[model samples]
Structure formats: structure tokens, C-alpha cells
Target chain A: MNTNFTHHQSAHCENGVASNLLKFNGIDISEPMVFGIGSGLFFFYLPLLKVNQAPAISYRPMPGFIFNKAAKRLGITVKRIKFSSPEKAQIALENNLKNNIPTGLQVGVYNLTYFPDEYRFHFNAHNLVVYGKTDNTFLISDPVMENVTTLTEAELEKVRFAKGTLSPKGQMYYPTHLPSEINWESAIKKGIKNTCSDMLAPVPIVGVAAMRYLAKSIRKWPKSKGVKVANHYLAQMIRMQEEIGTGGGGFRFIYAAFLQEAAIILKNDKLKELSFEMTQIGDLWRDFALNASRVCKNRSNVEDVYNTLADQLLHLANLEEKFFKELKKAI
Target chain B: MKKEEIPQDESNLSKSNVKELCYATDENGNYTTGLSTGWEAKTIALESSINTINERIEEAKENIKSGKASPIVYFMELHRMDWPTLADYVGLWQWRVKRHVKPSVFKKLNNKILQKYADAFQISVDELINYKGA
Candidate 1:
């Protein structure tokens, strides 16, 4: 591990890495501030979208959206590269570290040797910072880790070039330029306005609107595909909600936290009220995930569990709908 | 999202191994993060995933022993996937993947296809073909 690399466990990886790298470049910001100013919180329920043929239920924006958007908003120019060859990617990272610059990487989680077997999955958007190297071992600062870790160059290449499902394609990054000063007010307003629009977008498979559709669709799963398949969907949702690492309540809680921070930064009292409401909704999501897991695990045939889950989701949909509306008005 | 909800007495989570960090308090009332350790429910989920991995590894061992498949079959199983999932990874049709699952067909696969599968498993092609079950 590099003695100069400061590692602190964070709630989410992208925001964490973004925050850390920015800090290293002489900018002071918290993860929640980065997430909020970037408008990282979102709820997307796409039944037709499949990751490995499993329904994609994302609670945040896409992989690069948070960091890229956050950087753009803060007028920070980060050197982003998508390499065509693993050899070239390896050399670029080595050069950056040689220059005493910390580099950020988008890596596959499944093959990283340092990750606990339990925490490892096939996710390819995982981010970490490579700070220093001794011989062949590259010191790593995965934002989610309690301490700095190390990975061999070979192991790092394996995951950096990890294939299948959102392949990393040897992508890595480091900050290039920092604005003399940031216009926090404009950025905060823009983030809130864009998030409100995204949440309230008039579409069937997106935003708060999709939450209603997901509830309706979930209720119909048993009749359409039998109890076994319905349970499968339930299990998938639970994993999407819980096991995806750092995304508690599918990221509702983090977003609520962001809102809490935004409220203070922007000095908007209404945003604070809205933050509390969103936290309650996040808690409800946790409750729904818990209930669904119970029903699925116990093989409960009591249809009430399913009904309650649906109702809870619908309640969430309603809550978010009201939230975005009020949020738009507040701004 | 707290120790109360997570199992307190988890054997896997000794205090020294815990990761400490800050968390937002949502409102400002009860919201400071500290030397929090691993969560109980998260541990259970991890244990379950490990169980799934073990089951798949076991099944692949039997398949390898039976010579119904190449060692690549074991890596697919290690990823907790089936033929279709592997097919999806390599962009090969199900029938092609099905055929390649057999040791005979896998022997005939070209370096390109082998590379594809190796890339999917995040291992060298040789490693994919030489995986020994633990």
C-alpha cells in the first residue's frame, strides 16, 4: 500500500472516487456534495432492460454520468481515456503514477483479487484509484475498502480489460484541470432542476412514472409467469436493491443524504423538508426489500406479501411524484 | 442501515476489521458515522452468494469428471451462469456454446473463440482451459 494514498471507505464507489480524486487535486468536497451537485440520485425501473437477461432496475444514473456530469458542473476537466489495447492502457496508468498523479479506473469487480469473495460480482463499472506501485504490485484505493490494498499488474490488467456486460475496454482517468473557482449556486440549481425533470419525465419506463408501472407489472408477474418466475423477479429486485454494494435502498438513502447536504449548501429550507420526506421513502424501499426477501425465502404463498409489496411500491411512486413536483416548485 | 438492523454478533466481523466512514444523517438529528463494522444482513447475503458459488463449483466438478465438458465449463459455473449466459457473454449462439461445452468441441475451437471465452472469464485462455477445482 502507498503511504501517501489516503483511503477512506465511502457509501458509493463512483462518487467516492470522484470526491477523492478531486481532493487529491486540491479541491475540497464531500461525496454527498459531489453526488448532489452531479445529480446522481435517480430511480429507473426498466422491465424490458436486461443485464444478463435479468431485468435492469437501476436507482441511479449510468456509470460515467455521475463523475462526468459532476466534473463538468464544477468546471473540472478530467483526462478520460478508453484504450483500445490492454498494453497501452497499462502503460498510460504507469506513466500517470510515475508522474505522482493518482489515476482512476473503471474495473470489473469479479476478478479483482483483493475483493472478498462475498463482495465480488460481475459488475464492470466499479471504480478505484491507483496511486503507487512497488515492483509489480499496484497499490489500490477502492473507495469502498476500509484500507488501501494492492493488486498485481497482471491481476489489474485482467479486470481492467474485463469483458461482457458493460466492458471496461481498458478505461482509466485522472483529473487534468481545475477551475479557479466554482459557481456552486448555479451547479446546485442545475443539478436539482435536471433531477426533478428526470424524476417527473413523462415516460412509461422511466422516472417516478415507472414506479407506478413497476408496481402494476409486478402484481401481474404471478399470473403471467407462475409463482416460481414471479419469485425470481422478486429475488432479482432484492439483489438490485440490497446486494449491489453501497446502494442502500437502491440509492434512495444516499440521494436523501445528498438532498440533506444540498439543502444546507443552498440554504433552502424546503429542500430540507423534502430531504426528510425522501428519507422516509427510502426507508419504505428498505421495508419492501425486506418483506419481499422474507416471502421469497420462506416460500410464503400468502398472496398478501406480494400485494403489500406492490402497495408499498405504489406508495413510493406516489411519494416521488409528489417530491419532484414540490422540488420543481421549490426551485 | 444501522447496527440495529445488521446482526451485532457476526463472527466474521471482528471490531478491528470494521470500516469506519461518515454517513449523512438525512436531517441532522442522529447522523454521524464512525467505526461501524460489517452489517449482519449483508454478511448473510454474502454467505448466500458464497453458497451459490460453491454449489455451482460442485456441479462443474461432476461435469468435468464425467468428461461431458471442458474445463471452461467450470469457469462458467464459477460465474454462476449457464450455457445461455455464457453464450451471451461470448456473443456466440446457444448451439455453438452448447457444442463447445463438450471437451471434444472445445478442442476444435479456434484461438479467437478461446480468447473470447477467456476474456469473458477475466482469465488467460490457458487458465480457462486448465482450471482445476479447489
Candidate 2:
């Protein structure tokens, strides 16, 4: 099984897989483009949904979301399948690779031998592409890696069906048909519109509103659960921001880069300006993480820091609110 | 986010470059990363997280050694889980999981329950019952 797929390291997993699949299919879409057209920017603070015993704070949408959504927006046809058992999944993937079709998979990072030990968590939504096999090893294009790597068929099997939340269950996807051309203008408009909608979504726990929601939850932690829990909660927030694979701020930067590209393609100066503004917001987010880390580090007092952190989030939400509004009107 | 900002360093992952990424701007406003060698921020975060994990594992070890909790509790903490997460994995109620955390109840856990836990921890029942994590 040899698909001879080219591997390119990417900032984020799913977006990288989407871009690589598109490139393999001759579409040549960049990762940022896929992330943008997919409307990959999102925020959801689910205090009830615990990850590592802390409230869930996700910077982006679920795995495979960007690929599925971007393919739709670009008029590309893609096939997605999930297997009930590891045997069937392996067989299907082997057949695809034999046919020279690279397959994208969602697998748990915990069991992937090639993953850096420090980076390996119980995360099960990580995405990578499997394109070839030799002897007992499967060649994998993990977008986060610098080069192609190999996973033994046995090793691959475990990660494919790894247990815990968001189990992949052998989920795999590939582009069945990528159109020869694209309507960039309409695509850009739709992408921007959807992103604007996401940032402005009315739900209290979604969009920029979620930041405020998370801040409120942070404030409650010190009062309700005590300082230690609050510290963990804050650390988790920073992890969600800086540690977990170029998270919230990183995605924002990627989107800003996309907007910069869109500005050029659509000849819209406003998008270029928006891109700059978004970068500044990304910087603001980095600052938020820095200060929040201070509180987590126990270098700063909780009462002294929580209010500042909460206010920072409210400020970010307000900036985002206005930015998205202007973005919709600009397009 | 620019192409120029992408890190030239593709060093292997270590605790120092644990959160390695392609872009990390510096104080000089230059886009660079310690991907090849190491960066102070990445080092700190990695060490802190590892320390936290270690401290928790030590606590769990003490809890087990004192006979206040079972090995299951230790493994759960080792797996970076809370009781609710372990409960979800084993399809047991939180109360039942809490009960099972105690050595008195754990000694009486049936093969089925032990198997559920072993499956969750991805270990043999014997290993689940006996092994202390390094």
C-alpha cells in the first residue's frame, strides 16, 4: 500500500488533514484556507462538560468539522466513514491505501508511539492521514509532525479504537471529488458571514459570549470551590489557550492570515484591516493567558487577578462583537 | 502567521519544547520559536504540568499505601481522570465508583467490574489490582 502522499507539518491537526487531502486530490488548498472557509473559529465553555476534571474550554470546533465544512463550502465531494470494529477499519483503510487513496483518521493521541511524550494526552480527536504501508508499518502524515512517520499495524489499531471521550471508532475520510475550480468571492463571503454568526451567536455559552461565560465560571471557582480549584481551572484555561496545540490564539492568527489572503483575492481593503485587528485580538488573548498563568502560578492573588481576568475577557468579547459586525457589513 | 514566521527548528519533542509550535513571536517583535533547542515558556508549562501530575500520583500512592483507597484510585489519577470520568468509562454510577475507590469495597469487586476497570485502564485485571505506576 503506497499512496506516496506528501507530508506537511501544520499548526492544527484537522485543518492540516483537510489541506493535505485537498492537496493530494489536486485542489492545493492551504491549511489556513481550509480552516477559514470551514469557519473553524469557535468557542464553547461547557462547565458541565469536564475534561481532566476541569470545565471544558475548547478553542475550535470538534475534529473533522473543518474538513467536512470546508469541503461543503468549496463544492468538493468527500466521503466519511466510521467502522464499528478495528478489524473492519483496518481492512478498509488498507484497501484504500492499496488503491493509492490517502485516508484521514481521527485517533487517540495517547497510544500513538510517534507522539512526543509530553504532548501525549488522552485526547482522542486528533487527526492524521494514513497514506501507505510497508511490511508491518503504516506510513502516517500526522500534520503536527515535521515529516512522515510510521506506525506498526498493531500500534495503529490500538489508537484507532482508543477508549474514552470522543473515541474515533475507526473514523476515516478522504475527498472523493475536488472540483476543478472555485468561486472564491462567494466562498469568502459565506465564510466570513458564518464566522461572524459564530462569534455573535446568541447563546450564553457560545461565541465570544463563551469567554464571558468562562470568566463568570472562573470567578465562581474561588468563591464556591476554593482557591486550589480556581487555580486548576485557571491553569486549564491557559492550557486550552497556549498548550493544547496552538489553541485559541493560534487559531485566531490562522484566521487572520486567511483574512489577509482573502483581502488580496477579493481586493477588499476592509478584510486586510480586519486581519490586523484580529492579530491584535490574538495578542490580547496571549496577554490574557499570560496574566491568567500568573494567577495559576500562584504569583498573583486570586481576588486581585480574577477580576482583571474577567474584565479582560469582557473586553475581548466586546472587541470581537464589534469586529464580526463590521466583518459582515464589510463583505 | 506569515510563512517567514514559521519555525526553522524541527527538533525532537522534549519537556523543554513540549508545546512546540511553528510560530512564537519574541520581545523584539520577531517571529521565532525554540523548536530546535528550547523555550523558557514551554519549559515552564511542561515542568509545571508534569509536577502537578507527579504530585497527584504521589498523593494517590500515599492514599493506597495508607489503605484509604484502592489501586484503582491510583490508576484513575495516573490516567489523569476524575471519579466521574472513570465512572463513565466503566459504565458505573459515580457513587459506585466512589465506593470502589475504597480498598474494602475494591477487594469485593467482581470480575466483571474489575474487567471493566482493566479495560478502562487498558491493563490486565492483575495489573490493575497490583501494579503501582512508576
Off by over 4 Å in 1: A1-4, B1-30, B34-74, B81-95, B102-134
Pick by TM-score: which candidate is best?
2
Give a tens-digit lDDT track for model 1, residues B64-117. Answer: 877766887788877866565578679898898878878888888899999999
Model 2: clashing residue pairs?
Answer: none
Q: Write the per-residue lDDT of candidate 2 for residues B1-134, one digit (tens) a residue.
A: 33344333233354334334454345543333333233233334455566677789999898888878889878887777766557777888889989888788999989999999998888999998885433
Interface RMSD of each: 4.1, 4.3
The runs of at least 3 residues in candidate 2 whose Cα sits more than 4 Å from the true structure, single-residue gaps closed, are: A247-250, B1-19, B23-47, B83-99, B110-116, B119-124, B131-134
Can you write out model 1's per-residue Cα lDDT over A113-198, one digit (the tens) per residue? Answer: 76655556678899999999999999999887778888998899988977666778889998889999999888888888888998
